[model samples]
Structure formats: C-alpha cells, structure tokens
Target: MVASLSGWLQLRHTSRQLHSRLAPFSTSHASPSPSSSSLPQSTPSPSQSQEKERGAFSKLLLFLPGAITFGLGTWQLFRRQEKIEMLDYRRQRLEMEPVTCTRNNMASSESLEFRRIVCEGDFDEKKSVFVGPRSRSISGVTENGYYVITPLIPRETAPDGVQTPVLVNRGWVPRGWRDKVVSGEEDLDKPSTSSVASNTGDEKTASWWNVWSKKPTSPKAKEIVVPPPVKVVGVIRGSEKPSMFVPPNDPDSGQWFFVDVPMIARACGLPENSIYAEEIEDEHTAGAKNPYPIPKDVNTLIRYSVMPQDHLNYTATWYTLSAAVTFMAVKRIKTKKVRL
Candidate 1:
C-alpha cells in the first residue's frame, strides 16, 4: 500500500508540472493584448499620396479631346456669323446701281466680287471654251447643259491692273444643239423663211443664234464664235479652287469643268492669273426679242443666294457629345474613386 501511494503521488506531480508549462502558450494564442489591438494603423507616405494625386490628374487629361472638339464647335459658330454678315453685304452690293469699271476700281477686283459692274471689252472668239455637264434651270426645270466662257480683252485695263484678259461666263446652252432627237423638235418649230428673202447676201453669213433657231431645216450648228467689241454688264467673280469630287479640266482635250482661271488662261494662251467677269443679260441683242439661246437664263445670283449656313446645328452636336462623355468620365471617377 505504501509503494502504491508513492507512485500515484509522483505521477500527479508530473501532470501538474506539464499543465503549468502549456498554460502560457494556450492563453497567448486564444486572446491578444489590448495595447496591440488599440495601436494606430500605419498611414501612407507622401510619395504614395502624390501618386494618387497624379492618378486624378491623368483622369482629367482624358477630357483633352472633348475640350478640343468644343473649341472647334465654338470656332464654327464664329464662322457662321461671318457668313451671315457676308450674305448681307452681298445683298446690299447687288441692289446698288452697276458701277462703271475703271482701272482703279478694277484694281481691287477681289473686293468687287458679286458686285455689278459695266465693262467694255472685245470677246476673243478663238479662246472661247465650253464648260459642261453643268446643270441649267429651264422653265422651272433643271437640265444638263454647257456654259460658254469667253475670254474678254478689255478695251480698258483689267481690274487686277493687268491688261491680262478676263474670262466672261456668257451663259449656258443646251446640248440639244448636238443631239438630233432634241433638234428634231426645233425643226417642227421652223417658220417659212422662203419668203423672208434668202436671196440677201447677208443671210448666208447670219449669226450663229439666228441660224440655230431656224431648226434642222437650217444649216447645222456652227463653231463657237463671238461678235466684236461690246459693252458687258455683269458680276466680277473670282475663280474657285477645284473640288475633290470635280474632275480636273482637261486642257489637252479642250474639256473644261471648273472655271479655274489660271488653267483656262494657260489653255487658251491668255495671260495667267487672269481676272474674269460673268454676263448677266446681253445688251447686244438685235432688239427686245432675245435670240441665240432660245431661253436666256442668266444666273447673276448663283453664288450668294445659295450660301450654306448650318454652324449652329453642328456646334450643338459637338457640345452634346462632349457633355455626355464628360459626365460619364466624371461619374466613373467618382464611383471608383480612381482615375481612368
């Protein structure tokens, strides 16, 4: 009994010592200290803070394109206003009495665009060209035709201060002259000229217009030829730059599309950088009765009357797109608290 009691007491002492050694480890893992839990969190450094600022700045840069577009829209608005003023000026200029052109006044031809002017000049019939496939309005309907642009050598100096010849856009003519189907109708409209003195020696050398009006029964359409020095009243117009869609004038083939003054001058062996005028109505007609082009259609208001003015609409479109993009970008930045 004494040995059993001693052995039991020794085992109990060993168990107590083992429990004492394990107590600290179990308590340490189960519950941390208040000091450790209450300590402040580490704050980001200045460099990290600066990086976040840079990220925001980069997000703002995303609006660069939209800002540029907005600027362009503003510019277009200014252009629109300028065009309106120009139209007003043209209206006033056209209403004024036709100015008698002098070399001094003609010297400033660029400023005289769309202004009515009276010029005395001789038509260089040899240099006359037909610019065609142009559309012409006849009796409220449009038809394909050609414009007769004849170079006029001014008895006076050209407005550009050069004796250089100017091109005169006389007017448009129907291709019916060349088409037999169209000319067939003109034949039916012919009046009996048998009793109208065909015996007159001057009848054989009749003007191209008088002969053309006589129909198929009359002589065939003659080559383009203009009469002598005459007084021309019309608008002084500057040549327009060639358009992307318009085919370039073929000088070699004698085909002209645009009134490219320099090209036409070179092709016609006239002075380069030529100044030109358009004829509104012919004062050289035999009487009040107009002949040559059966229907004389003079387009004095062709350019100024149809100027385009739509900048406001374009500005609104660009602004709307910019606003939408800006709103989306701002919302994204706010929601994500980050830069795109």
Candidate 2:
C-alpha cells in the first residue's frame, strides 16, 4: 500500500510540471476578455486632439489666400466687361452726328457726354481760368501745357435779362504762352517785356520809383478784345472727381489742376451748375503752325481712361496664382494622408 501511494504522488508531480509548460502557450493564443476588448481604446490625449484640430485649421488657412485671390480675379473680369460696355457706348455716341446745344437741350448733359454739339455763343475773355500744368503729346513730342477754360455767354438771354453761360475748355497752350492766350494775343512769337529784360539785363537798371522802393516795375496790362458772337463746336463733359493722388483745387490761389466744373464756375462768377464742354479741334486747323490752343481730337475724347487689357492681365495673374495654390494644397493633403 505504501509503494502504490508513493507512485501516485510522483504522477501528480509530473502532471503539475506539464501543465505549467503549456500555460504560457495557452495565454499567448487566448482571445482578449470581453471587458478589456470593449473598453474605450486609450482615449487620445488633449494635446493629440488639439494637434489634429490645428492641422485641419492650418489646411483651411492655406486655402484662404487662394479663395480671396479667386474672388478678386472674378471681380476684375466683371470690371473688364463693364469697361468694354462703357467704351462701346462711348464709341456709339461719338459716331452720331453733332446736335445743337442750347439752353433747351443742355439739361440732358449726362446723356450727351462725349457727344459733339454746336452752340452759338460769345466768349467772356475776362473770366478765363488757366488749369495746368497738363502734359500733351504733340507730333510724338511731349510738351507741358495749360488748359484755358473760358465762359461762353449764349446769344439768347434768360427771362431776367441775364445771360447764363457755359464753361468751355478752349484748348491747351504751351506753359510759357498762358499769359499770351489770356491777353487775347493771336501770336505768341513776340517776346514779352520780362523776356526782353532778362535777355538784355534791363532789369538791373532801376528807375527812380524802383530804386527808392526796391520793388520791381509792374508791366502794363494789355488790352483784351472781346471775341464776337460765334458758333462753338464741342463735346459735353461731366464734372471731374479728384483722385486721392490729385491735389485739391485751390481757387483762392488760382491754382487749378483737374477740371472741377462747380468750383471753376464759382471762381469765374458763373452759376454752380454751368454746362462744361471741351472744344473739338477742327481737322482743317490741325496742321496750323504753332496753334496756341490745340484742342483734343475726337478719338482722345472717347478713349477709355483704363484699358480692358489691363484688367485681363490682372485676371490672368490672379487665376494662375489661385490654381497653383489649390494644386499645392491638394498635394499636401494627399501627402499627409499617405503618411498617416
């Protein structure tokens, strides 16, 4: 009985050793517990979540500039279309025959802008305003000049026996000939007293009045002959709005840059809403020798200030940049996805 008991104990020990050897393999092959498998996967840390949100936000930021540029490009295209339409309208108006411009028909000046018109009037030479220094391209030569703005009184008087006049941009004159034009001189070839004095040094010789007061002699005023009542052919022009870069018109100082219809009318003692017109140069007189006041041609009057080609160029530039940015953004997104 003792031998049988000892043999049974040995068998029990051998079985315990085999069970321990198989325990590691069983654990390795076993499926996860239900509680462990179902537990929420280790939740992303606050830092990791914030990093993911930042990545999305950065991607959006990359598209913002492209979107803005794309919108600007579309706006430019619209502007280009508007410019084209405006130019077409102007061309149509210029093609039509000139209409008679009188007090009766001058009320629709806005519609008549850039349209040629004829008016019978006499110029008020005393109320001439010089606006300068404008630059002109004459026969491929750039010349600095001033525009002479004169008031024209109609042959017919108002009910109150007052002549309501219109403002006319007579034409452009050389910078040195402003006084000659103002003095109603047909010829600018004659040298002025100031020029003679400067050439001959006559200014150094002081007269009795000048020697005592130490002041320069004032030149005698030239007689201005009023032009007879005549017919003027011109295009109706609207009031000019000064750009931010343009300096304000100084009426007190008589320094005029751009044509401000209202301000110029007030300065010249005319009605605030006086009609403004730019004289069209006669084709016959275009080749006249040294024409003091050279009027602008029909083409110049109807030309667009900003060309449509400029807008087209801007549109192309913006669109190209937008496309490039979109391509790069998409590529970056794909790269990130591949890495993830």
Candidate 3:
C-alpha cells in the first residue's frame, strides 16, 4: 500500500512539473508589438495584433507550481477558520450548562450524551474506592491513593417523580487513610487545600458526622445505611487522573490512575456501565474543585470553563501569506511574456 502511494505521489510530482513548465504561457495576458516602429499614421490590423499577443503569451509557462502551493495555503487557512469557529461556539454554549466534577458521570449503557442530571439518594460510602492521583501529590510525583467516589441515591421532591442514586466522586486521599477513617476520630474542619484536605466531607453530615469522615466503600457490607437519605445536585462528567510519569517507588496502585469507567463500576460490584451524576443547583455557583471563585452571574460559568483561543489572528496570517504567494506568482508570469 505504501509503495503504491509513493508511486502515485511520484507520478503526481512529474505531472505537476510538466504543468509548471506550461502554465505561465496559459496565464499570460501580455502582447508583442514594435514599440519603436514609425509608421505613416497606420497600425497593424486587429487580427495581426491579436496574433502577436497570443504568440507572446505562449512564451510564458513556468508558474503552475506556485499556483498549486498558493491553493493549498488557501485551503489550510479556510480549515483553520472553521475549526476556530467551532471551538468558539462550544466554549460559549458550555457556559449555560453546569460544570460538575469529572467523576460524577460514568457511562451506564455505552450509549448516552453527557448532560445535567439530578439524583436522589444518600451515599453508600463504604463501597467507594479512591484512585491515586499524581496531580496532587507531595513527593513531586504520584503516590499510592484513590479518588473516593460514593453512590448517591437520586430522588425528586419537586413533584417531578425523579429518584435514583448516582455515584459521587467526593475526592482523593492517600492509601492508608481509608483504614484510618474512624467515624469519631477525624476532624473535617480544616482550611487546607492539599489532596487529603480536598476530600474532607462538606455540608453533607451532621455537626458530628460531618467532620472528617471516610464513608466506607461498602455501606451494605458495613450495615451502615440506617439514616435519613442525602439528596445531591450535580452534573454528569468524565474523570481522568493520569499516572503516565510517576516514580516507580510508590505502590503499583499509585500507577493505576485514570478512571477506567468500566473497571470502576465492576469494582463496585455493579454492571460495568453504571451511570453516574455530578450535583448542581439551578442557582449557579462556582463548580466544585473550580480553581476560581464562582462569579455572581452564574451565566459565565461555561465561558470560564470553555475558554476561546486567539486563532483568528493566525488564520489571518496564513491567508495573507497565501495571497502574497499567489500575487507574486501572477506577477512573475506576466514578466515572462515576450515583447516585440
């Protein structure tokens, strides 16, 4: 296949060379005339002048290469413009939709578009697993740990009859922390921004239970689901924490980053494609884990999340280069015409 393509390319090159040797003449518009001829108030007949002009044009035929090059440049510029516009449109549209945590949405049926969804149910903290993340490690490298994701039972109280429990990616913590998560011993009230601190329970628990807590990964196995249900509002999303370049000193689990949605559901003892959700209220606010504070106008969230690029400036540059080459090629071909 490769050899065939190479041969075809070689043929094309030869054809282009032949065309270049003949193009200047076809594109020429000049005429040949004796500029210094002194006549007795008489000029060549119209047919004679036209014949000379055509002969002069025939002398130019070396410009097809530059024309083809300019055409390709023009095509690239057009493609670049379309891509930039599409990205711009997506950026603008993303603002109206909520920005939820990435781990909230796991594919359920291998067929679904990611979108906003509300789930009603309390978390089964006992069955959750936290994936180790290199993005937030202290050794300047990835460490052994997991991102804690608990299932949230979804319900609808707005007279809408919607109820289901979706998964919630609470946050990340080191490996040993799971066993250390004694209900009464951990303190959740800390103004820290490290990986461990990032996973501390938020406004979900009572004054006592809300404090630093490690909801088990299997609440059913622990027999701990006896309580009022917790309601959650968030968005559905994809999660990924790559371990592509972590030091090998850490446990192999640390190297096992990036949420394989299928693997995650299977580990939960659920079918491989269970659907998940991220919480978000109609009253907009900064997204959880958002580096910046929420803007007063929630309308700007999508714009903030899906930022635009300065590609139009580059597009203009490419178009300008193409136009310049084309113009120069045209001018050169004109210069090649013979004058009589």
- TM-score (C-alpha) between model 2 and the true structure: 0.71
Query: How are the candidates ranked when ordered by TM-score, highest leading?
Result: 2, 1, 3
lDDT of 1 at 301: 59
Among all windows of 10 consecutive residues in model 1, the one with the lowest summed lDDT is 188-197
Model 1 agreement with the true structure over 226-315: per-residue lDDT tens digits = 343456677777777766998988988877888887778787787675667777765454342434333233444543433445677888
Q: Which candidate number maximizes lDDT?
A: 2
Off by over 4 Å in 3: 1-114, 126-148, 153-165, 170-227, 238-259, 281-309, 321-340
lDDT, each prediction: 0.67, 0.77, 0.48
| Count of residue pairs whose backbone atoms collide, per candidate | 1, 0, 38
TM-score of candidate 1 to 2 decimals:
0.59
- Candidate 3: residue 272 lDDT (0-100): 51
RMSD in angstroms, all models?
10.7, 11.2, 26.0
> Candidate 2: deviation at residue 222, Å?
23
TM-score of each: 0.59, 0.71, 0.38
Give the per-residue lDDT digits (tens) of candidate 3, residues 83-120: 66755654554444533322333324232223444444
